[model samples]
Target: MSIITFEHSFFTYPQQIKSLISEGLVDFGAWYLMNDEQTSRRFEGLQTRYPDRRLYPFAKRDDNDDIACFDGSDNTTVHVIHDFANSGWEQKEIFPNIDAWLEYAEECNLQNESS
Candidate 1:
């Protein structure tokens, strides 16, 4: 049900992500993919605020301000950025791709739900 429906032509999500969406597997527990407007707005804001980083935000954590974004240079590797980080991109955690991120998100969700 988390499959995103983008209105804008700005969908540069990785092929793996697209494949998962096509297979109806978009939800990752607490991490939800953003809608077109949300993605676009957050992408713009992130770019302006952190010009050194090339990030394309696609998802956000429901409980906090953390965001999951694709590396704009490759559109494959995923980065999880923490809002509390004063060092900005330095505090971002890298995942090999959306697949790894999905696994991590699911694990985190399970832990959160059990507690």
Candidate 2:
């Protein structure tokens, strides 16, 4: 799989995200982190779709296609954007950094396995 590296032009991924990608630990319960190529496409698509928001999409929910992206100006902050919103799109600050997001993802996986 294509991993985000320093050469990536879209955005400089925070260390937490880079480490996870390097380790090949992209899957987290219902979410799947996009490879470098997918991320590039997703970023370009979002730029056209929502010019007002600067999002660097890295992961997405399999169930509803909610996007997990980093703030363009600040790679550390992560947000989940609603892709299927009926009355336009909505976004929420779900994690302070990629590390927190990974923790949440791992927790969800554990919960799923328990069930």
Model 1 regions more than 4 Å off = 1-11, 87-90
Best by TM-score: 1
Q: Roughly what TM-score does model 1 have, to 2 decimal places?
A: 0.81
- lDDT of each residue in 20-107, candidate 2, tens digit only: 7678777787888887777888788777777777888888877676789987688887888875454245675479878788777777
> Could you tell me the lDDT of residue 35 within candidate 1?
68
After TM-score superposition, the amount by which residue 40's alpha carbon in candidate 2 deviates from its true location, in angstroms, is 1.3
Q: 113, model 2: CA deviation in Å?
A: 5.9
The total number of steric clashes, by the backbone 3 Å criterion, in model 2 comes to 0
- Residue 63, model 1: lDDT of 85
lDDT of each: 0.74, 0.75
What are the TM-scores, per candidate, against the unseen true structure?
A: 0.81, 0.79
Error of 1 at 111 (Å): 1.6
| Runs off by more than 4 Å, candidate 2 | 1-7, 84-88, 110-115
- True lDDT of residue 112, candidate 1: 95
